[model samples]
Target: MIRTVLVALPLIVFAIAGLLAPLLSPYDPTSGDLAAGLQPPSVDHLLGTDQLGRDQLSRLLHGAQISLAVTAAVLALSLTVGVVAGAVAGYLGGRIDRVISRVIDMAISLPGMLVALAVIGVRGPGVVNLVIAMSLWAWSPYARIARAKVAGMRDSPHLDALRLLGAGPVRVIGKHLLPPALGPCLVYASTDVGAIVLGVATLSFLGLGVPPPFAEWGQMLIEGRPFLASTWWLAYPPGIAITAVVFASNLLGERLAGGDERPSILRWILPARRDRTVCAKDDVVLRVQDLSVGYPRRVVADVSYEVRRGEVLAVVGESGSGKSTSVLAPFGLLDPTAVVTGSIGHTKRVGVVFQDNLAVFNPLRTIGSHVDEAVRNAGRRPVRRVSEELLALVGLPAVARSYPHELSGGMRQRVQIAIALAGEPELLIADEPTSALDVTVQAQLLDLLARLRDELSMAMIVVSHDLAVVSRLADNVAVMYAGRIVESGPLLTVINSPAHPYTRGLLDAVPRPGAAPGTRFRTMPGRGGAGPDDSAGCAFAPRCPIAVPACGQGRPVLDVVTAGHRSACPEEGV
Candidate 1:
């Protein structure tokens, strides 16, 4: 609390000065004494006099009124307009949301100064004109922040409950949605105050803000610039005032947003290391060796795999087995907190398809636009033509005009595949692509993937918990348990003659061909998710049905059980 107060002190002081400039200032700021012009500090004028003979102290106090008043006006107008529009758009999604979002994006992309210059250029500068100019560009950031916040809450349970209680849209939004959205907006507004103040000063510096005889910080600086050498007091005072306010506003905002903790500057300054440590064979499309990922704790360790040209390596595991982490960390796709270390060698570009197509896509953007962006990123020319071709390749042609929310789950997944294929990648990684779809759609997608693989001769990595799903797609399979690959080999070899108990349990869980109706499916006894470093011995030892005392004694390394097949069971005895 004390730290926050200290951070806020400068702005508080400036606000007080601006609000009480009449009481604080000793003389009329605009009236000047020509005879006493450019005088140094004295008992009568403690801050000295400007070239126009205006009291520096009185001008500064009045300047604070002009600068901060414009800042306050701009901030209030922008915040109100931005927050209301954003909340309404987010609540009533679809075309309204898309249009508002597009406008926000355009506004944010436009240079704020340029927008202000354009507005002020059209209408001659004054306080009202200056406020309007700055408000135009300033509103977009608040709108974006509010839209994101409100969008996340649009489908929440509280909103649903309110709707059930016969609450109208206005009450629901103005009372509930806007209040929470205003919290973050206020934090952002705190920082934005500094920018608005600086902008006002800059425009005045360029002679586009308050006219002559007006006491503005920017006007004072411009007036003082010519006399900077003779009177250091002229420039330094307002400059110091501007610097102090900006610094204080930023610190206050940071405190409100994340408390006292500040992020490491080195994190932004230093570049990420992309050093490739190993090479793969020409036939090998990808070689991942000793890959480990953690959120400061080892979740995946010493994971290794290879995908050769025209081959599919399916990583089979239950939920939380680190299959997704192991694949995504190599490509820098995990959360920023994740610590990834290891070597991943791939010869060419890789494309990825994630499950949950709804989450993968922007609801505001059309499917075609998404594909076109990916296509453009891959250096493909004639973006529309190539994007259409890729969409047609994935059996989703002519859906370019459709938004993500408009498409069915199956069609959305197909669009995701098309986006992935936009790169014409040599290797494709699909993370549970068919998990959420129906059996029919799932089969169709798997067939489409297999056909694409054969046609393009691209290597693939398919991560799945259902071994049955990958049975028709994978050429080879790796079974993971507790962040370690317990068994791996050719699909048929591991499927028919699994050596590891966990693998056997997974195979048992799959619905067998001759199962009677109403039969209960096989299930493992204990839950399976454990990190690699959670135990001194094997992570899967606790859940292994056939485990002995020796099973938990030490970590078991994969040993060759047959030609092109391996199992990480100590019972195998290498």
Candidate 2:
């Protein structure tokens, strides 16, 4: 609180002084009393007369108003330009990012003061010209800062989650990116106020500011220079005022810089509500048919899956098996370069818990706002009861006021779940939600998911490498290898009587606590790997111990093996 006050005091004082300048000035700044010209401090003229015989004290007070105004105007204009340019560049990336970044660098390379001076010299000194000149140079600092921050933040999991929630680019940027960026940008802009004021003063001293008779600090200094040897009052007061204002601004900037400046925690917590009521008739809440995701280097071909209402579908795969990509594609959150062809049916609403929880939140926004954004995007009506229930549901009732950084890893994941639950989504896609957590927390989260499924009757697709996590949460399992689903069946069938070689290997790898000591854990032979241009053959042939001679010719389709069980291998039939 004290820090906030200290940081705010200078700005408040500067504003007040500027506003009250007219009332506070003892004499008309433009009125020239020739008799008092060059006079030192006296009872009649408090700070004596300047070269033009104007009241120096009165002029100084009025001058402060112009300086502060110019500072504010330039700050506002520059920040607006910089933030918009940087945000667009950072979010879009590639060519757009490069173009904007280069432009910013070009602008920054120029000597800012020299450019301002040249612009003022050409445009002629006035408030409008001063603002334009200052902003031309001023925007670069903010742009650079905004670009760096946004570039690092654009690919955040929170943004990916937002994209999947049907939030358009504008909404995501406006609601999420802008708010977080505003705090640091505001600090930067405010601190630049002092510099802007000084720049205006410099221009005025160079006779590039407001015309004479319009009192300005720089003009006052110019007028008072001759009298400095005779009457210190003529120059001292205005000089002191400038010094005091600049000093206060600097102090405020420093305080704001050092203050508890993390993004608001409420942005992440408050808006999540589970309001979507489910009916039993909608058994297939989410259906992705013939889904294919194509990356620059590889393609996930003709993958089809269905998640039953309130049932979990676990997609298990090694790294780069396209499990995450498949889920992301159905959610309409794939990378721009990635082409997705598939129809997602009955996806009225979707919620996603990404692998990285920290990246799933806007650092600037509070937990409450993040949740609220999710709620709003989910098209759900605002209901306090629902929001509170969700917070409690995610086991993060007290973290409502905390930002993402303040929360622990487990806590952040819980918040992410709360965010996913905000819209009462019919389909929940969790991509390795427990990967970063300890076993205890992972177990707790999985249990929480089970409880949520029972209570909310939500359909979920959980992607995981840990078969145990999948077995615990999923009713159906799809084992993916090298961008293809090699086998899928009821969880019981796949786990107890696994058909695919990869599936068997995966299950066998799980450590048995009671196993004999010095026992080597079962390991899968061959690294399940494929190149982008690998022939349309079985992706897992190299790793399959049971691979037949025909396995290398063409990829086998998922053929039915048993009731609701399928495997894409000729060996399965053998």
Candidate 3:
């Protein structure tokens, strides 16, 4: 933003001077006083009189009107044509993108100066012809940039979600596609302005543009060329002015475009700012009250829970029970299709351990580099030191230089934990943290998590289908079924004496040693998936063993059972 202002300052001054050219200058730009020809700087003529005895400052100010106007017109024309073409091509791929891209390549290959000269030669030298010729090829760069940007972003999650919401192509492109594409295009147009202006002057210099004693910078230069040795004042002023404008514009545009070729040490030198935590005033790490995640249909609804510092809230449910969706909703990490509702509060930032280590970890980056990136993003300098410490903390002291593929499943999970810890986030969300690990490794990782929670004083929300894991690690438990939490409370109470039938069903399904050898384990009847989107009654009524006709009358909510315990239905208990 600073760069943009600085570059625009010179143009602002030129505009004011141009508008007041007659008032500011003591002499007419065209009607030169030949009697005082070949004069250098004096009290009367600020920049001296030209060979035509015209005030140099006056001609320069007047020339700015023509130059600035032509550049502005060119930018408007180029961007309009380029952006429209590129957007259509990018968003609607196949023949359209290929055909337009081919045309762009051909157009770019044409020699711009030669094409302009040829056009001027055919139509004769004039401003209209000059503008037409220059504008012919000016849009190519913007077209290519817009096309690439839109094509890359066309399949992004948000755009896909917008489509699923029944948004038309025009609305989607205008709202989602154009914004990202506009940035690079604007930067190109800004920096290209000075060049386009300079091109106009060059055309005039070659007798292909504004000709005569009409007070143009190029025409003035032409008149002063013979006196180069005799007087430097004649040509140097216009030359310096042109150079300054282009330099300032390029400097500003490059920065605004964020064209940094590589990372800078300055990022490390700058002190990091601490963002205010969003946790409750009473030391609650995270809280989600009446939260619901909406897809095209509502997936999870009216779920509420809180996690105090160092406490783990395990969200347990079977497949398609919205365990992942419910846990992720609090962090605002659900898919874009999910319209999350209700309140979520956290005192500090969050970090996560993803379900698939390979999908989340960059294939090209080593464990150390991955940890370094996380640390750097968190504003910690010298990532090497922090990464080393975090690796030791996660019990992988020797695996810093190892790649994701090089480590075992457990070691990779530790790397994920280390990366999460790098941010020093107050709340950590681990989605099915033990799913891919062997039983022994899962036990080790859960134990590691317990120790880390104690050491870091951070709260966690772990999503899983395993009851044994929850009983061991979770302080609080929320059992979900049919896109809703059936029961929630202290883990011990919920585990030992669950009050909701759905919660009881989940616990009963797990195989027990007391059962006879070779006896089959219990399983819930019905699909046990998310309920119909428009259903008015309890979604789990169909599968509930104790469900009566009244259970289908209305949606049930979490009602208080015992102290510090809640159940969605009052009918069942362990």
Candidate 4:
């Protein structure tokens, strides 16, 4: 917060001075005495007088007011027109998108100064004309940015769901779409402020901006240019002012775009500590101790687990239960917003297979390129040979020449697996690997994974919301609720005789094999997962069926129910 304020200080001061220029300036900027002409800095005029004997300080103040007003006007006009046009084009993609995109490209391709000059030349130079000229080219860049953002989100499932619920184009765009699109546009606008200010000054310097007698920064610079050697005060102050605002504006944009985890500076200042605890066993491939990850707010808290050679550890929970966060945190896969504090001791070489292969594999690149790149990154020689072998090993043949989009979803997943295997990793992590596939495809992937695990003797961590999905692969199970591990033990022991209420609920929710045809699966009351710190007691207390008043009093810790089995529920014994 302090950092943000510090970054914005210059703009803040400039704005304040511009808004209160009349009250602040001691002498009228336009009215000047010939006797005071060419005077240097003194008590009467702090910044000295211009060639017209005008107070430099007063002129600067009023120049700020004019400059700021024009900048704000340009930004408002450009942002609104550009964002609206771009969003409409992106959302209603077809001939309209292509046309708008072409226009945006042409405008951007044209030199900005030339475009401005052309508009001012035809319209005649004035404050309004200058604004129109700058805005004509300026709005195009903003439109392009907004259009790209909206285009990416146009086909999202969220939009489909909104449309299903009878939402019209306006509400969908205004409420769901425009808000996210506006973020990037505003970030761009921060930097654009400097450009607009500079442009205004440049045009005014060329006598194309706010008419004569007006106290403009560019006008002052032009008027004082001839007297540069004698009266340095006139030009230096305005130049410094412009430079300061530009530098500050650029810095502010960077700050806004980067947020908390700025890789350029913040990462170096406070690096992520990877303090791994040494494992006693030589075969222990992965060990996580007290893993806690947060986005400033605690999400995954004090979770610990380990995977030995040839062993599989399954992290299972509902959405937002921190299942993915806990597993992915060790690999540094979470977004920069995440603040991970934990010790993860793992093999030097680790491979990961994400849930959505479509997202994982670049659509533009051929399957061969991705695999070859991975092979190269793993420090292997003969990239083509290694990539082909990896692809074959994953049961894919002749697919090296094909692009990611040309293949089926399952085929794409196999390609992802092939890419993961390129590293020949000692440990492999799959996060919801089969969540999006059909039953048959999911079974095939799981079987393939099992075969790989057995053949390679590699440790694995599989994350999923479904207990049944991980049953085929995982030897040990760790059930997470909120951000903490609620139950953990051998998969058979936990699944057959679950000690925690949440675990039992999850099991009950799964469809039984021999249940009556009309039987409905049980659903736990209340929401599934929340932040660990959201409640002083158990996060699942509201949803737990066998909850007692005591369950709401304090948080429960894992207690040994049987050998290798533990439950967080204090009432498990009862």
Candidate 5:
């Protein structure tokens, strides 16, 4: 509360001072009174009169109006130019990114004051020219900061989420990208405000600022310099005013640059609330049929799956088997260059918990706000109350006041989960939610997820490389090897009586608790398998221990081995 007051006071004071300068000055700043000349601290002339017999105080106040106006104008103009250029460069990488980056580098390499001077020299000194000159140099700071920030944002999960929501480049950049970028841009703009004021003053002092009768602070300093030794009142008052105003603006900008965690106290006093409800039991929550996701090569192929109400379907595979890709593709979140073909259907709301929690959030925004945004975007009810409740649900009640950087990896993951559950999604897609945490935290998160699944009666699709995770969470299992599902069935049946050679190999790969110390287990060979072209044949044939002659000719179909079990192997048919 104290911090907010300290930050806001200066801005309010400066704004009032800037707006009311003309009406408040005591005397005409340019009119001379020869009888009052060279007076110092007189009762009749507060702050005394200058060498030219002008009211020093009045001139100083009027000068502030010019300096503040220039600063405000420069900040607005520079930030606009910087944000547009930077966002374009960062969002569209490769050639465009390179070209924009090079241009920014060239601009930054030049001395700012010198560039401003050169521009002023050409345009002729005035309030308009000063603003233009300051803006030319000022934009580079925002460009650099925004470009760096946008580079990081390009790979963010929220961006992926927006893309999956069918938002085009313009909408995504305008809505999602611009709002988050505002924090850093504002911080940079504040600092630039101070720099611009100083630049304008420097130019005025050099006779390049507003013309003589305007009474700008920089011009006062320039005009007073000749009489400084005999009449200290001539130069000191305007100089002091310039210092105080710039200092106040800098301090305010610094505080704002830190970021605003909550809105105002008034906003909190009238806090808005929202209500969240669970989906119906009969809802056909989620479906992905024959979903094949490929990068340069096919990473996961011919995978068919579905999640009914209140069920969990876990997709388990090694790191390269495309478990992540399968989930991302169905969400329409993959890069445009990646080839994906599949059909997906779900009547319930869809939400995802990504592998890296921090990557999904804006580092500048509070966790509570992000949760609130999710609730709003999903059109959920009880927005404020549900956001807080969801935070508590994920064991992160205290995280409402914290930014992404302040939270631990596990805490961040929990926050991510809270955000996903904000809308009470009927289908939750958790992709390696526990991969970055320690065992204890991982277990806690897993338990929380299980409880939430039952409480909300939501279907969940869990993707992971850990078979143990699958064993604990999945009611049904889909086993992926290379780029295709080699076996899938009820968890117990698939684990205990696996049919495909690849499934057996995967089961053997799980380390046993009682195994001898340093004992190596059976391993698959040959460079962890082949590229997508290898899709012409059985994806796992090259690595399968029992591969036969026919395994090399063509890929096999998933033949039924039991009522709910299927395997893709000709040898299994034999």
Candidate 6:
């Protein structure tokens, strides 16, 4: 409430003063009485008299008229020139962009205030000259902003579709580019409004403003300057007015821009992964070797693992350790730009249960609708019958008519499993399946998956960050770091005795009730790996507590420590 009052109060006061100037004050501002010279603000005048004994209140009120007029005119003119120039330059690149950009560079190079001074000095300082001088360089920033906006939208699929549908330059700019760009462009323009007012006031105070007796705030300041000792009222009010208006516009501009700094959805979509195809020599349900995902930067690399019939292998890691990248390849969901090396071998049907069930299930469709569609798409049984059977199998028969949003998180996930099962897959990949559920619900889901795995004799690959989930259900574990699997072995063997430094660090970082009362919780000292950019060395070397000189020399390949157990490090300890 206080903020609203602060922002609105000045606006209301100035607007009314400018609009109702004539009626608000009875005295004629220009024709002051010599007999009442230097009157200390009484019934006749509210603020006090200036050096000329003019009614200060009346003059201040009228001064707003020029201030507002110049501000509005300058804004309109600058925006027109800037937005148009910037849009043309950015949208149509090549020679046109270069030429316009150079011109903008030149315009900004000549200081605006200096140019204004020269123009006003020659034109003999007045409202018209002041407006023209201030406007000369104002439009350049707006144009540059607009052009950048247009360039960003150039490769947008929707815009390309519009062009393919025969959109002209006018249609594209007016309908598509300008509207979205306007939000930020106007934000830039609004910030300049405050500066423009200050600039005008500054020029006026220095004697280049509208001539005396015109009732301008800057001229008022000059008139009040000599009375600094006894009368502070002379200089203070105009200064306060200028400060208020400029400060208010800055706050208003920030509000107008609607600041939201989240990443765009387009950033999520990259080039689909290209596979290198590593053919497995042994007979297995799924085999992937030498897999790396991306260009410019790789998220996951040197990945090699296999899943046998009825085997449950869990790929575990921290959030960005490439857990999702490792599992997503079998479903063919990796970005097109991602460079996926190593072949993924799977002969039978593959069923996938995604992490976010709310996003996976259509809000408009009922639980049964999805099941029915999946069953029908497979061409096996009647939609109603097969869907009902699948639903019953996953313990969601009562939710057949319920929409996805109507069900709880766990229930929605169960429905997703039922849909996946409709394909009768030999291999099922559940990515972060139990991460979003409560303890009770998670246990139930895990038991359900275990039951399903046993009943169907299915091979499963589960991807998760929660070591608890991995420990409970996985037959074997693949510990991932910086996109590569640093360790793999039987679940009990990996948990009871982790082989890699990263695997040990991950286990140590988890909080436990078994610690001493004053024991501080543990954390990995550095980032787990070489990050997305460093491609030459062992990713975990920087954070590895036992790291030696040889660790950073080159990438380490996985070596067998025991019969089925493996570790990527070449250290002495097995």
User: What are the runs in model 5 whose C-alpha is more than 4 Å off?
Assistant: 1-283, 294-297, 380-383, 516-518, 531-536, 572-574
* TM-score, every prediction: 0.53, 0.54, 0.52, 0.52, 0.54, 0.51
lDDT tens readout by residue for model 6, 279-306: 2212377888777787547777768888
TM-score of candidate 1 to 2 decimals: 0.53
Residues 193-289, candidate 1: write the lDDT tens digits.
8888899999999999999898999999999999998899898899999999999998787667555432221121111111121232237878889
Model 5 per-residue lDDT tens digits across residues 59-166: 877777877888888888988888878887888789988998898887877898999889989999888888899888788767777777788999889888888989
Better of 2 and 3 by lDDT: 3
**lDDT (0 to 1) per candidate:** 0.86, 0.78, 0.78, 0.86, 0.76, 0.78
Clashing pairs in 3: 277-347, 278-346, 278-347, 279-346, 279-347, 294-339
Deviating ranges (above 4 Å) for candidate 3: 1-282, 532-536, 572-574
CA RMSD of each candidate after superposition: 18.6, 13.0, 14.7, 20.3, 11.3, 18.6
Candidate 1: where is the Cα deviation over 4 Å? 1-282, 572-574
Give stretches of model 4 more than 4 Å off: 1-282
454-537 per-residue lDDT for model 4 (tens digits) = 666667899999999899889999999999999999999999999998999899989989999999989988887668973578
- What does candidate 6 score on TM? 0.51
Q: Which stretches of candidate 6 lie over 4 Å from their true place?
A: 1-6, 106-110, 154-181, 259-338, 341-574
Native-referenced Cα lDDT, model 1: 0.86
Q: In what order do the candidates fall by TM-score, top score first?
A: 2, 5, 1, 3, 4, 6
Write out the backbone clash pairs for model 5. Answer: 274-381, 274-382, 274-383, 275-381, 275-382, 301-483
> What does candidate 3's lDDT look like per residue over 1-574, in tens digits?
5645766777667767767887887778887888988788999888988887888878888887777677777788888778878887899999999999998787677888788888889999777787887877888888888998899988989888999999998998787788788888997887887788788878887777887867666766777788999988888887776776677666566555443222332222111211122233247877788877776677777778888876899999888888888777766677767787899887667889989877888775578878876876776544566667778878898987788899988888888998887776778889998987898999999999998766556688999988777777899998888778889899999988888887888888787867888897778798876643335687777888888899888778788989989988867543
